[model samples]
Target: MNTQIQRNYEAAKQIYANLGIDTEKAIVKLKDIKISMHCWQGDDVRGFLNKDQDLTGGISVTGNYPGAARTPEELRQDLEKAYSLIPGKHKLNLHAIYADTDEKIDLDEIEPRHYEKWVQWAKKQGLGLDFNPTCFSHPKSDDGFTLSHPNKEIRDFWIEHCKRARKVGEYFGKETGQPCVTNVWIPDGFKDQPVDRLGPRERLQASLDEVFKEEINPAYNLDAIESKLFGIGSESYVVGSHEFYMGYGLTRNKLICLDAGHFHPTEVVSNKLSALSLFSEGMLLHVSRPVRWDSDHVVTMDDETLAIARELVVHNLISKTHIGLDFFDASINRVAAWVIGTRNMLKALLRAMLEPTESLKEAELRGDYTTRLALMEELKSYPFGAVWDYYCESSNVPVREDWLKEVKDYETNVLLKRD
Candidate 1:
């Protein structure tokens, strides 16, 4: 530990002490919160199916940056490097397509054994694993639909795939001793206006029912459904709109996934957390920075992200929320992208934890709006960076801007060497 960092942290602690907040307790609490980091960013959403498939599902990864992981081993290596720099024990979010086998395993035929390597890896790292059913980037999803496809055969294929994915998720949960959140997100929409939207939604609901027919123990696995407003090719209409999934999640007792970029440009996902937590069993958050559209850019310490952390802390919904990152930016260093996004997320959570919640609530309850606003504004200038630096130091990860040197060294010695 650097002496300078400890000195700064102690000073910051005293400042927080004056506000009736314990900085030490905040750091300890932050350590317990684990953010699920997505695996797709390392490979630009290109899984090791070896089928020469193009990305579908109204999703696309722009920029042909060098050194994208071409194999499961490389991806895991990059993830390990990234995780070593991030504080706290975290979870890895995997898609069904990231199976570590060389065999031509069809999506419908995938089994838990296919992901045994990932289970073993997570076990070694003492990390939990979450899962997703890849309903896109395959021949079956060429029509910009899967679960809601007009063809029963295609829909059945997707249903079977989701069933297998749930089983895999259960296996992960059992192995890691944490509930695996199995999320379902499909790109079932139309580029042009669809006259029969209700038909597709009905089919989708039926498909979901069939997929989730088998009951898995809540201890092992939980189900979640994600909705998207618009995508690259599905700008005209999205079948699985927010209203559709919100209703389904409430009625079916499933976790509703709220992607930061899945709603309108003006819609704040942070604002919806409390409202949804009131009815839904739980919720999955896909944290990403969207540039105008649903472009999965790396997250930063932006207002929206900070607001999300604030909501989770203020509402005490951290336990009920399954936090996960969902972004794929191939333009920069892939490992650096993971470190930046994950660190920013942790920082936001830390900032929220260091808030003077008790005082703020007391002021609010007493109808002291002026003091509430003043305290809120004053908190913006707190020595959050000092606390964050202390956190990185105590967690044994690189502190502040110092972590960049390690990334640069890795890029030179490892990434740049890749053809």
Candidate 2:
């Protein structure tokens, strides 16, 4: 093994030891699927397809290359290149609304170009594209939507933009075989005092309704609409923040997406499960770990907090969902960053697979918060390294007695056997 591989193995072994896990059996519980920077290894993504050691069926791409293309042809070429890099099983995470340029461009001009390129690209490649659209300010949202300013011009401009994007989405679904994704990770609410942007919630809700009604169709749907509670940098967030919670509560569309790191750490808020509770709603799940519960997206499998989050995914609390390996690294080599990230994510997934099934379902329906929390605590105590020692000790992994009884009690008394 290379130095890094050796180092990782040793580190994992040490973690297992510290957690009182048996090194041999612990390795058996590890297996998962992933795609990452290595998915685009060496910029020759096609080269690594079905060849790289990591898991398969997961890869995402920004629209074409890095810089904005001036024409439809340039966009088409970028799409083609992105397609070439994608595997047959993977979907392309297209950046429909770029942070800088997308906010500025006229929807009328940009939508046609996007539509033409997406249609042609699908024809040539036989694959559908997923969208990542932004909904926030630049020069246009200066006064805010219906929420902040209620200015006719700003809201009208956004209305036009949403209409154009929805048209493009409809065209994409009709021509290509992919569903339209309404990615509204908007930073609309403020962190501090808001002198000018009061009653922002009304504007936001009105805008959402208008956009949905005008742009979206009964059949033309959203695969996953993201709902971020907060944001970093100059961008603000809706949903989780105090100013936005009421608005977020009111705006309940199906198939909402939640970032794992978005919630306050060590809390069982079940942001993923909460999204599912919305009548007939589904979710697109984004998994990333926060350092100190901030946006330090260095997700690792070894993190216990992440393991708890993993329990949610494996138990199928939220189904019909797509996954995003959400990570941003400015300091490391891009390839290395993805490799490390992919590895960590896969490990978490594998551990989740080992999670006990029916009991989890039971916990969900019981409405007993205490029982559910205890069950999660038990699930977390699976004896990462030493099964024997784990059993001998006060660990959660059932050994001598029927551990199923404990699981049953929690399910029956607490959750009332919903499973």
Can you give the TM-score per candidate against the true fold? 0.99, 0.57
TM-score of candidate 1 on Cα atoms, chains taken together: 0.99
Give the winner by lDDT. Answer: 1
**Whole-model lDDT for model 2 versus the true structure?**
0.45
The reply for model 2, stretches above 4 Å from the true place, is: 1-88, 98-108, 115-128, 142-148, 195-198, 215-220, 223-225, 232-252, 266-275, 278-280, 292-298, 302-309, 312-314, 339-347, 356-419
lDDT of all predictions: 0.93, 0.45
Where is the poorest 10-residue window by lDDT in model 2? 48-57
Scored by TM-score, the top model is 1
For model 2 the TM-score comes to 0.57
Q: lDDT for model 1, on a 0 to 1 scale?
A: 0.93
Q: What is candidate 1's lDDT per residue for 252-304, written digit by digit as tens? A: 99999999999999898999999999999999999999887688899999999
lDDT of 2 by residue, 1-419 (tens): 23543454456556655545445453333312212221222222222111222211112222232233333344344434433322222334444443123234443234645446445655676655455443342445433222234576766666666656666666666666556554544545454455654466667656656666653562544634454444543234342243253234335554565566666566433433544545435555556656645353545765543654464555454244555556544333333334345445544554554454445667677777677777668657653323232322222223323433543443345323222
Model 1 spans > 4 angstroms off: none
